[model samples]
Target: MTRTNLSDIISCLSGYDPDAMSVTQARQVINDFVPPLATFEKLAIRSALDRVLAQDIVSGINVPANDNSAMDGYALRGDDLPASGERTLPVVATIHAGQHYAHNVSAGTCVRIMTGAVMPDGCDTVIPQELTHAATDGAVTIPAGAVKTGDNRRRAGEDLRTGQTALRRGKILRPADIGMLASLGVAEVAVQRRLRVAFFSTGDELRSVGEVLTPGCVYDSNRYTLYGMLKRLGCEMLDMGVINDDPAALEAAFRRAAEDADAVITSGGVSVGAADYTKQIMQQLGDMSFWKIGMRPGRPMAFGRIASGDKEAYLFGLPGNPVAVMISFYFIVRDALLHMMGAEQAPLPRLQVVSRSAIRKRPGRTEYQRGILSADDDGIWRVRLTGEQGSGILRSMSDANCIVVLNDDQGNVASGDLVQVVLFDGLV
Candidate 1:
């Protein structure tokens, strides 16, 4: 099925205004307009890292499979321990992880157990080896308060029960997820196919990395940055290089990209200052919206779908400025593309922090300022702007660890005022 049109979705919202779209409103529209692709691939569990699960993984058996000891210690019945002070018990047999004790543990006696070893029958408590004192006659003394009943024991099916869902569908697999599957004895998994994304820059003045640059031309950095971002997101990226602003070249590039990829990202030519032909050509080939979003840096954006004969691909037309391209890609296109890849990821949290300095901002627009988060003298985390907030300044993005988000209705931020920030890097 095709995605819902933006106009149809906008009509559902109260007091909808297209000319001045809020960040939240824009996001909602995009969410409604984009749907997950329906394709899956089978992959080995180890190779499925960062891939979205296509089906729920139901546990065939309990995770531990049997009741086991969580520590190298003595396992005995709780009723056998003295109420206070200490109790001495005879050690029946030693249980290693791979082997089991054949006989049930008798009353007032304990079985020496290693970590992950099966808990002897009739034993409900464990005292670590360090917490117990061994007597001359192979008896072990455990202090009254050393452990409670069922202490240091891992119950069967505690982590995962048989016939229960171990991992849900649409979840992006991570290291912990892979390890969990391994523990479940799952060697392979079904995952959504990787998304194929084609991107390019649209400027005659832009040159490739190895190409000799003219006096007025600059090397294209957007393609390199786009490559890194898409690669990190586990996408199959097709860097289409720089397509000149000429009509024939632009149309040919768009057609080829739509035919080969699930999505196309182009930088430049959507802004009002550019040739009117940019929007005209886009509309001629597909259904698109040229929007002036109520945001700083990345105000101009074209979002819709383009067709090449029978094939079609989603299009994201970003601004020409370096920082604007990155900002727009992160805030607007990233989530939509992830959805296309069939990944159900939680939204990046916007954490609140105090601003270290004053920032001038106008109301009715959201601002994304690159910032460095640091601890103050009192160890309170605060954010400071990395440098100039100009959209053309790429170094600001590089030096920043986070992005200070100023709300659409909010004005200038005074020093020490609480502001919302989204971290670029996080400890997983």
Candidate 2:
């Protein structure tokens, strides 16, 4: 299929405004610009965690392969069960897991079956061992109302059937998915190759760890945080370290990153008043756009693709502020990379929670405030700000459990008003 151009996509969008790019508009455009790499590799199921599946996995056989007992009980024909009184029957045989009874169960006879043991033919019910009385005389008595027909029997292929799709393509494998694949007797699966992401921090005032601090320089923390985030996303990282703000140095770094990586991410030099040569160098190399997105902490962003010689890579130029860099990567670049990796996972749902204190906000732009989500006095889930919310305040993000999201049309929130929040950690 021919790839769609970014300009064509933007022109088709109704109500598009370039100067005041809405959060939704910016995300949609970025998603359209990037494409997933068409490559896959086979790996053992145990080693495929968090990797996107490249092909649909179909089951070759039924999961359980037989009707089995879910508990240690007596398996008997349902017709032999007394309607309202006690019933006693001879214990014909005992069936253990991985073993089956050779003879069919007849009326007035039952089999002592262990958990996961296959039920004998003609047996439709299982009365738990704890609910029955067994005697030394090879007889068992089931009390009235012990169990209904098919109460404890698990049907064959209940969990998965032969020729059925066990899992679809583009799913990120989790623990349960690995177990499921094992149950289906899958030894290996084809998954997308890990994405190659090259990142760097730019600024003349940035210093590396262990380097002597200059009078006006600060230690670079963005690279460390970016490493963690990219590692969590399962990308092959290429840290290019800190690039000086000199025009020639920045240009060389951009060219090398584009030639070697699928995507290039740089912190600083995108915002106004920092450096004019950064934007000029980016445009001279590729179709990059510097936009003032209508969002808090991450408003200044440069996006598009850059090229060197015959190779090209997508670029994400984010702000230099520590908190702003983290937020931009999570809210903006994360989704784009997931798409580039061909993951079809849905966006995380924003949970509705009450605000414990009033939040000062303006309308027109979206605000993402660092929040501490906890249960209130009534044990109801609520969110409160983590004190200061400045873009440069990294401590606020460190102390937050979630990001309280106020939409573009939302105004200042009252103390008791319900708000939307997205958690940093999840069960998946």
Best by TM-score: 2
* Clash count per candidate: 0, 0
lDDT per model vs. reference: 0.88, 0.90
**What TM-score does candidate 2 reach?**
0.97
Tens digits of per-residue lDDT for model 2, 350-427: 999999999999999999999999996788999999998999999998899999999999999999999999999961
Candidate 1 per-residue lDDT, tens place, 1-428, comes to: 56566567777977666678777877777778777889998999989998999999999999899999999888999888778999889987888998988788989999888999988889988889998886433788888888888789899999999999999999989999999999999999999999999999988899999999999999899998899889888899999999887898889999999899999999999977555356677888998877888998899888888899999998999888999999988888888888898888678899899999999999999999999998888989999999799999999999999999998889999999999999998411
lDDT of 2: 0.90
Instruction: Please give the TM-score that candidate 1 achieves against the real structure.
Output: 0.97
Q: Which pairs clash in model 2?
A: none
Cα-lDDT of candidate 1: 0.88
Cα RMSD (Å) per model?
1.7, 1.5
